[model samples]
Target chain A: MEVFIYGLARGSTLALMAVGFSFAYGVSRLPNFAHGAFYILAGFATWVFAQSLGLNYVLSIAISLVLLAAIGAAMYRFILIRVRGMEVSEIIASYALGVAILEALRCKFVGTGFSTPVFIEGTIKVAGVPIDLQRVVIIAGGVVVIGLIWAFTHYTRLGLSLRGIAQDERAALMLGIDSDRAATIALAIGSALAALAAVIILPVGSITVNEGYDVLISALAVCIIGGLGSWTGTILAAFILGFAGTLTATYIGTMWESVVVVAAIILVLLLKPSGLFGRQKEFEERV
Target chain B: MDILEVKDLMVFYENAIAINNVSIKCETGKVTGIFGSNSAGKSTLMYAISGIMMDMKRKEEMKGGERITVVGEMRLNGEDIMDIKPNDRARKGVVLCPERRRIFPESSVLENLKIGGYLASRSQAQETLKYVFTLFPALKDMKGKEGGFLSGGEQQMLAIGRALMAQPKLLLLDEPLLGLSPAMETRLAQAIKKINEQIGITILVAEQYARPILPVIDYGYVLENGGKVLEGTAQELIDNPDVKEAYFGV
Candidate 1:
């Protein structure tokens, strides 16, 4: 029961972390490897606002999300825009930028500790297993994000336009949905989502540069196992990885968590190269 | 009056010319046909008029790949629009029903139509959606079905219906009959005529097989190897020996 409860929390965290990355890739086809940077940066920014500047925590979160979104949009517009079609350059460029931001943050806060206050602070026993309210919040937050995204893509024009551009760029262009504009919106929204996840999860532990890299790894794993463009696949992959990690840690050893994640990625790759729901371009009907 | 006029348009990928000094015009409220065999620059010409070549050129440059050069004047309603972005041109009422029916495979038929109506106002989209359904009832029947699951004939009809949802003044259709049965081909050809006659939307259709299309076109141009080979009324093209033998396969 404890593993089950915690596994849900862990799975939701993974989903929140990767949803933005998956979404941006789906719409813009640009892999924002800087997703980790956005997450860590937002954490620090919120810390500074709420702790250092002594502002309202909620306001700090809102402001930090906006700033992160702007930064993300600028990154895509200036850097990723130049390498739109070259997949390797996009990966390298975004990853390098991510490393640069993280390293720069480390330089500033090396001697100091950064952490955000959780929205709620308490513990509750569920199924006789004590779970923190923060974990419940994380689970709830993840569900809300997923639901909002589903509604956004289904009911909103901008969301539909983004989905349209993602599906077929030429077809969307024919309908006056500009790919550049859509990509910019996607990057902004992607960054905001990453920040939202950061604010929710950073409360559980200290904000560390090490965790930024780990976040990136988790997101990549989720996206890869889910298939890059499949949202439902991302959620399912997150749960599978989360449960597997929790199970392995409980049964085998805590140290085997990372190993298990990597092994699962390799196994999935070997078994289903295009992912569970990913479109295998070579096999899909062209028309 | 001419709704679209391309004068001495030249397109090149690196050094290889895709469109070689081609000039064509589509009269307002009339169906103009551009016919050619495979590799005859028919698709290139369609892309050029719809302003998608600009996007292609931009993508190529961004990738540091082949240099795509498009030169010459293109006017939509007597205003020069040669260098505009594809989406902006679409906003200005030029839409392309791309070859091979590039409908959104993941989206349902209704969603596909809604995406096509991206530029229209809410009421306009609703009205056009109704019009589209009436024109292609199969699309209405498959409103809940994903586009990928549709048959080839149904896909082509959806493609045309999708284009109509865009509220276009000049519709550019590239190979609307590339892969379809004779019955479907004839039906789409008739639908194209109905769209022009009823809605009075100007159309420029490019196809390799000109048999069904030729019957509905007002004026036609024959393109061979990226250059214009012949230009005349539909009857005149039918009367021309080379066009009849090459396009009609008769």
Candidate 2:
């Protein structure tokens, strides 16, 4: 039961991470492979502001989110916008961003040692299992975040416009959805979610630039397993991967489990190229 | 007073000119038909007026000149609409249903209609949804179905219905009757007449199939090779032997 509780806690953080990837891809139609770099940067930024400076933990997180969102918006205007016209160019630019972010993070604080502050501290029991209070907080926070996003997309005009653009960009623009504004908003929201995930996960483990690739690969696998454009699919896929990974780790060595997990994802994609929940582009509109 | 006026509007694809110095006007409460052969810049003109062309310019390193403008010299009593944004243009009574029956493929039929009324309040949008459902009652049953699953005729209905949700003074429809059966065409034409006469909205329709549109259009412009070759009343153009040879080919 404790093992199950641990799996659920880890799944909550994975859900948060996958949600950002799915949300950004839905609205922007860009893979944003550099998203893991944003995850790493969020930890580094929060560490510098919140831990190093000893500022209020919440205030540092707020600063980290705003800073990362600005980075995302700037990248959109400068790099993404330039390459958006060419598919190959956009992918190449995204990888370039990833490399640059890794180098910048390495230069700043690898030696100084950066760590994110614990947002929720203590212990609690759930279903007769003793779980860290932070785990319960993570689960509750993930639910609230997901609920808020669903509400925002359904209830607000801007959110509706964003969803409209995701479905049909040109039509949305013709309807006056402001494709540029919608893209910016999606990027900002996606970046903030990534940051939140980093904060929640940090209490469980230390974060580092070298681990960036692991996060990227795991989040990407979750994205593909669930489907690239479906938010619900991403969260569900993350949970599936999390539980599956935990079960495999318990039975087998952790080293061999990653390979088995990836092979399973590959098998699923071979059967369904659009992922578990993604719709095939049959009759989809093209501009 | 003209609801929309385009003067010397030119659009180009890279180095090639798609539309050159094209100008036309639609007076209040009239259906103005733009008829053209394939590649005659009919759709290009529509894009320029509707602001779709403005977005294309950014990608091609092109810029819109000061010469081309939209919603000009029109008034509901005395307010100029040219100053309004494309979406706000709908609120101020100018709307475009668009060509190729651009329905939201993944959304429900009801959700598809709601897109047309993107600027309306929740209650207002819902009310407009009811009005549109009444016109195309086939949509009432399919509110939960994905738009892509609809038949071509039904998709066209949803498109027209979506545009009506905006409740505009001037509704611009591009190729509304394209890719449909003869029976469907007649039914759609009847639906359009009901919209104009009953709902009291002015319409401007562009078509390659001139026969179906000719019966309903008041004034017509015949375009050949991106230029206005002729302009006259529907009957006057029908009577002209030149129009018969070039357009009607009768």
Candidate 3:
């Protein structure tokens, strides 16, 4: 019961971290390597607002989220826009920006001593396992986020256009959907999501620069194993990795967690090169 | 009155000319056709008119790949619109139903139509959706089906329906008949005529097969090796020996 409960919470956390990355990639085919940097930045930004400025916790989170979203949009408009179609350049450019921001934060005092306050205080017993209220919030928040995204993509015009652009960019363009505008909006939303996840999940642990790299790796692992750009696949891969990590920690050793995540990615790549749900282009019907 | 007029339009991919000194005019509320074989600049002409060539040019430049050059005067309703972006042009009522029916594969039929109606008002979208379902009743039954799973005829219908959802004044259909059976081609040709007659939307259709399309077009142009070789009314084209030999397969 304890293992299952903890694994579910971890899986939800992974989902939250990866959803934004997957969404941005799906729309623009742009892999935002800065996603982890943005996540950590949100945590620190909130801490500064709430701790230093002495603002309300909720207000600090809202302001930081908006700030992160604007930063993301600016990142795409100013930097990523020039290198949009070149895959190698996109990766290099985004990763460089991410490293620059994270390293700058390191210089400023975002370390192990900094942490955000949790939304709620206390613990609850569920299925004979004691789980923190924050963990429950994370799990519920993940589901709500996923549901909202699903509805947005299905019912809203802007969301529909994003899906259209993701499927066939030129086709969407022909219909008058501006590709650059959609991509910019995608980046903004993606960044805001990363921030939301950070604010919700950071309360459980202290902030550190090292966590930036770890979050990126875990998000990448989930995205790769589930197939990049697939929302359903991301959630499924998260649970798979989450349970595997929990089992390894319980049975083998806690140090094997990272090893298991990496191994899962390697094994998935070896078995299915296009991830699990990726619609292989070569197999697509060409008439 | 001419809805669209292109004069001395020249398009080049690096040094190779894809369309050279081509001039064409589409009259308001009429179906104009351009017939050409593969690599004959039919798609290029459509892209140039729809302003998508500019987008391709930008993408190519960004990748440091081929340099695309487009030079010409394109007038829509007597106003020069060569500098407008594709989406802006779409807002100005020019929409392209692209080649191979580039419908969103993962989205359902209804969702694809809704996406195409991005620039439309809420009421316009709703009314257009109803019109599309009425025009292609077959789509109404398959509203939930994924676009990738549709048949060639159905996909082509959906493509036209999707373009109609954009509420274009001048619709550019790039090879709408590609990969369809003879019966489907004839049916689509008739539907194109009905759209023009009923909705009064000006249409420019590009195709390699001229047999089914020739009967529906008011005026047609023949392109060969990236240059216009002939232009005449549909009757004149059918009577011309060269057209009957090359295009009619007579």
Candidate 4:
């Protein structure tokens, strides 16, 4: 029961970290390598706003989210736009930006000493397992976010345009959807999502600059195992990895948790290069 | 008056000419056809007029792939649109039901229509949705099916219906009859005529096969090797021996 509850919470956290990455790739075909850096940046920004600048917690989170969204848009407008179609260049450019941001933060005052306060302080027992109220929030938040994303894509105009572009860019263009504008919106939304995940998850533990790389790795592993750009796949892969990590920590050792996640990714890639539900390249161009 | 006019248009990929000084006029509420064989620049002309060529050129340039040059004067409703973006062109009521029916394969038939109607007001979208269902009742049945799963003829119908949802003043159909049976071709040709007549939407259709399309077009241009070789009304084209031999297979 404990493993189940903890796995569920862990899976939700993984989903929160990876969904933005999958969404950005799905809409723009650009893998946002800086997703981890954005996550860490949001955590630090929120901390700076709330703790250092003496702003309200809710206001700090709101301001940091908006600022992260702008940074994401600028990242695309200035850097990613020039190298849009080249896959290698996109990966390189985004990864470079991510590394730069993370290393710069490390150079600054961000260290083991900084941590964000949790929204609520309480513990609840579900089936005799003591769980933090925030853990419950994480699981519920994940479902709500996924549901909202599904509804947005189905019912909203901008979301429909994003789906249209994702399927066939030129076709969307013929229909009057601007490709660059859609990509920019996608990047901004993706960054904001990263920030939201940070704000929610960072309160559980102290803010560490190295967690940026760990978050990126976790997100990449989940996305790769799930199938890049497949939201359902991301969720499924997250749960699989989440449970695997939890089970390994429970049985073998906590040191083997990261190993289990990485091993699953490698296994998935070796067995099915396109991941579980990834749209194959050959099928993409069918009329 | 012409709703769309292309005068002295030329397109080049690197140094090779794709469209050589081709000019065509589309009169309001009329069906204008351009017929050509493979590599005859029919698709290029359609792309140029719809402003997709500019996108292609930019993409190619960004990739350092090819040098594409387009020299043309495109006037839509007496307004010069040579420098406008493709989406802006679409907003100006010029929508392309692209070649090969590039409907969003992952999207359901209903969702595909909604995406096409991105530029329409709510009431306009609703009204057009009803009109599309009436025009192509087959699509009404498969409203929830993915576009990629539809049959060729059904996909063609969906493509046209989706374009109508855009509230286009001018609709460009690029090879709407490709890969369809003779019966399906004839049926689509009739539907094309109905759209032009019922909606009074000006159409510029480009096709390699002229037999089914030529009969329905009010005026047609025959393109050979990127240049306009012949042009006339349906009756005049049918009467010309060279046109008959080349296009009509008579």
How well is each residue in A1-287 modelled by candidate 2, as lDDT tens digits?
A: 86687778777878887788789888877777778888888888888887778888888888888888888777777878776756677768876897799878888766535666466667777888788777787888788888998888766667767777888777776665667777777877787778877877776667788777777888889989988887878888888887887777778868877886688689879998888888567475532
Range of the 10 consecutive residues with the lowest summed lDDT in candidate 4 chain B:
B241-250
- Cα lDDT tens digits for candidate 3, B1-250: 9999999999999999999999999999999999989999999999999999999999999988999999989999999999999998998999999898887888889888999999899999999999889888999999999898889899999999999999999999999999998899999999999899988999999999899999899999999989999999999999999889898777
Candidate 4 per-residue lDDT over residues A64-166, each given as its tens digit: 9999999999999999999999999999999999999999999885548998898889999999999999888889888988898999999999999999998
Question: Interface RMSD, all models, one decimal each?
Answer: 1.7, 3.9, 1.3, 1.7
Q: In candidate 2, what fraction of native interface contacts survive? A: 0.31
> Candidate 2 or 3, higher lDDT?
3
Candidate 4 runs further than 4 Å off: A282-287
Give the DockQ-based CAPRI class for model 4: medium
After superposition, candidate 3 runs with Cα above 4 Å error: none
For model 1, residues A71-94, the per-residue Cα lDDT tens digits are: 989998999888888899999999
Candidate 1, after superposition: displacement of residue A23 in Å? 0.9
lDDT of each: 0.91, 0.76, 0.92, 0.92
lDDT of 1: 0.91
Where does candidate 4 chain A have its weakest 10-residue lDDT segment? A278-287
TM-scores of the models, in the order given: 0.97, 0.87, 0.98, 0.98
Give lDDT tens digits, candidate 4, residues B72-93. 7999999999999999999999
Candidate 1 has a TM-score of 0.97
Model 2 chain A worst lDDT window (10 residues) = A110-119
**RMSD in order of candidates:** 1.4, 4.1, 1.1, 1.3
